[model samples]
Target: MNVALVTGGPGAATVGPCTAAPSPDLHYRLPSAFNDASSKNGRAMPIDLDEVPSRGSQCASAGKRRSWIPGAAFLAVLFGSIALAQSPPGTPPPASAPADLRQSKGVLLADRPDDTLLLAVEAFDDGSIGLVVSSLAPRCRVPEDVFDLPVQVDRAGFQLKHVIRQQQPQPDGACAESIATVYQAEHYWPLKTATAVTLHLPWGAVPLNEAGLAYLKSITPARPPPALPDDAATYSGLLDQLTELLAAGRNQEARAAAEKVLPYFVQRPPDEGGRFFGILGTARRRTSDLSLAAASFEVGIRLLEIAGDTHSLGVVSDNLATVRRLQKRLPEAEAASDRAIAAFESLDTPGGKASLGGAYNNRSLILWDQGSPELALVYNEKALALLKVAYRDDPQALRPFLEDNKFLRKAIKTP
Candidate 1:
């Protein structure tokens, strides 16, 4: 599922601990997709989040299993960027629909300006061009108070206006939120090529269309990625347990369980393998450890390749791109986002649709860093719309946490 919510502390509150020290109640239900119970040490102890060592370094290795796959969860806050996925080569040509998209009329699909990575853009006979902006982060303009000792309403309003302008919006509907959604839908793109380019005004609605997001409503049954080949039933059961622990904010316990499930990860089906690695990688990042997180994603990507899963690989690539961004390797970061976007565009599964959010998230970050927060708002909204669909069933399942509301508001208002 897709993911965030702000006011960022532990991201979620916990009544107690979530440890593998004890078996979860037999009749106890857990959070949807995330906290994995099976990943715990064989003891199945009821190690709740409250019981785990809160002071333990989030990065401290928890004795990983030799057979474990790469990951358990992701922290939406670690690095400050999002993504933009490009359409893949050999896909059906697009038709005019939204201003956000255009055909590649005369322009060539060159490699990313910073990275030497060869791009896979498909130029159409039509002249309209489609450029894949990469490496997105979804932070509202840095909160005014984070800088000044005191808060200024006037300054806040100014920053808010700046954020709104980037969305380029016109309100619709009676409800502000609904109106914002419709306004954003104006910028929505649905696998189509468009003509309009330059925006005369800085303000416009980011795309958050009802139709474009229809796919999001169709949440897949809490199933693992189809490619995962291990004991699907087993991994599925374990994943559910882990999610419960996470939802309740049991980071340490969740981490422990993640390790126990590692061995089954390598040969388990592709979707599951990549997904596991992606989760584990995220868990590492939540603790502020970038190197291991990057390694986890790399391992996940390798597993997905073997599973013949182009879509999951794209997701892993996005994960890798974000990790690179944290390492300050802008060039590599951009290329990874590009590849992730390309991979998603080339796929036909729901994962492809959901993965677009990650691309937009990464791309938004890149724009924000370039002194273009205005543009970043538009892309951030796009990712928000996608995440709404993806995480409708399960939002708070990951660690490090995401600012779902902050980003959602950012999506609606752009400023």
Candidate 2:
């Protein structure tokens, strides 16, 4: 499975938040997920692709149910006619075709085989047109040359219609085999007055088939996107700088950066709440502000628990335990670590198991300091085994824990 977002700074000379390793899961907030100030946290409020506007839809048609056509044979027929400039010698002629067909007017034509092609058209208020065309072949991609599609719309009563060419065709990577492409173009015609239009592709003047035309007309127009919150960009920039500063062991700078974004924590969704506060807690811990670190982590934990974000909850709780340990709050620290372990166990992934290892190690340290070396040894050993798997990708990543385990082993041997 792909690892989720893991954001934390490195630790100091001893075991702490940074040394307590969690797998890397960077959940960057892309613009598409949250266009406006309020919609920034889509993890808790994921946008429905189908409900998005036609021009701005981030929909993935991959893995959906589709009535497919025989791709190879159909393309062969369509392109074959183009290559020879005529129908095959023995092939029957196409049935009588319609005239003055246009996309906006909802002109319908006869259906082709299921595996042929699918097209969706969207017209905007500013005379802009968007087209989504997909090749239905199971393993075939749309030929690169076909992307240079040029078409002319034949409006009734006008001697000539507007001609448009695809300046760009963005490929949709979601589909495994078929090529789903989107084209955005503009026309000079008055969209409302156009009674009929015909698309003149390289192969021929293809009328909008019934299914294609219906699908195009059914699309909802996109709304003008909302503006972002004034502080959104600044807050994000600060968090990024904080992560970098913490990574570089510049605790003071990291703490200051965290403070800049801390006020906005309440406005974030659970996932982002856990992320920002967790980062803040790290900065506070590195600077030895145990109380502030614990406070930040508590808020983060509350948000994660409310959102059922167990994965982040587990990592942040582990960090909180470390801060509590530094403050000599043994009971509180142990309790927090226990919660972390529980959260990790529930995750059941490699990253989760690795996080649990860090929690176990922290608990072992607390137990050792409390004069229970024998009991601490058991937890330490368990931590070592789990951490080995967690850092399997880079054994050096486990160096700190490996050294700690070795020290614990030698200490337990003493009288």
What TM-score, computed on C-alpha atoms, does each candidate reach? 0.38, 0.44
**Every candidate's lDDT:** 0.39, 0.48
Candidate 2 structure quality by residue, lDDT tens digits, 266-289: 334455656677776776666654
Which digits, one per residue and each the tens of the lDDT, describe model 1 over residues 304-370? 6666677667877887777666666667777877877788878767667667776777766755555
- How far off is residue 174 in model 1, in Å? 69
> How far in Å is the alpha carbon of 167 misplaced in model 1?
50
Q: Per-residue lDDT for 82 in model 2?
A: 24
Error of 1 at 73 (Å): 42
lDDT of 1 at 74: 11
Question: Lowest-scoring 10 consecutive residues by lDDT in candidate 1?
Answer: 174-183
